[model samples]
Target: MSIRLTPLGRMVVPVLVLVGLIGLNGWLSATMGRGPWLDVDKVFHLAIGIVVSWVFYYLLRQKHDAVPHYGFFGAGMMLGASGWFPLVSQGLLFSALPDWDITLFGIGSHRNPAFHSALIPFFLVIGLLHYRGMRDFAIGLSVGVCSHLLVDLCQSASSHPDWYRPNFYPIVRGMYGPFAVLWMLGNALIAAGLAYGAAGRQPALVRMEREGFE
Candidate 1:
């Protein structure tokens, strides 16, 4: 007895799994309330990290024709790089990187403008320009970091209205209000557009048939 999934199923399964995980997290958050181990912020960060990484994978996969074909190994490598591992690791690291100044130099608050600023991504883009080979990986890391900051900003606004400023420290300070919600929606729209564009670009079964793998 063998089971086969259609191309649509292949895509839908991962989405369904993600939704299920999110639902579980919500349930846990509601039941557990606030605790050191089950902090809402931590769970939210992990969930967003995973989802963003998955989206990044599809985005990179969309340009199948443009990039080199490493086949199964490439797919696995991308998964490991963008999925929970690098996304969560790099995302958490970059997000916290900004706070180090507080402990080390005691110059500014934890949410320093230098690290959390939107300009950070532009700098990352410049790095990619100079180092072309690391484009995909760099993009994945940047997305992770940016997404983390966006979520943190939203959380900070909702939880601590007094300190809801979104700008980097000492530069300009203003409330984010509902901008984070809009930003999340924008991210979803971008992911959907990428997936729609890549939908039938190169079905694996078709490739298998052509390559005599079936």
Candidate 2:
């Protein structure tokens, strides 16, 4: 016999597990400080973000009275973009929006404000989410961003080579200072601009129907 969880339970149990994994990693990092055991090999944890995506998807699906959950229709544009049509185009890149600094400009730093800091984009998430038809799209886009952070957090917690800074700096990089600026703008603007465009798009057939082309 297998134990099954309810929808809410499904969401809650995994979150608790993720938190515990993070805490365990923290405790190990504090005691070990990148100890010799990992000196000969590297460890990268990518599973956490995939797990957390469920929570993100769940929260994004909640029915808000005013905006309502747009379901598949609201998120159709992004799903297609991230899906097999082109198979992971811009939507996948949005997951790494913060890395634009190094990838595009060749600037590498411990922490960059442009993309790492959440001061501005935090609010942009709320603003974009409130738009009439953007709820699911915002959720899809934000899951990518949040998963980006979760991957960093996992790296920092484990003291992996990719993120050797202290947990505070690597996890949040809260006070770091951005094309350095554009990273932050990139984070928000990419999501907002994409969502805005996707939201306004009407299929050509629909437009033709309205204009009597068909």
Number of clashing pairs per prediction, in order: 2, 3
lDDT of 2 by residue, 1-214 (tens): 9998898898888878778766765665566554323411112122343454455445434532222244643233222222212212233332244444444555444345555544333454467543434545454444444444444543544554433333323333353222322343355445434433433332442455467764
Those runs of model 2 whose alpha carbons end farther than 4 Å from true positions after fitting are 1-3, 12-47, 59-95, 107-110, 119-135, 160-214
Model 1 TM-score, 2 decimals: 0.48
Q: Which candidate comes out best when scored by lDDT?
A: 1
What is the C-alpha RMSD, rounded to one decimal, of candidate 1? 9.0
Candidate 2, residue 193: Cα displacement in angstroms equals 19
List the pairs of residues colliding in candidate 1: 113-168, 113-169
lDDT of 2 at 138: 50
Model 1 agreement with the true structure over 167-199: per-residue lDDT tens digits: 322221232434444444354344333323333
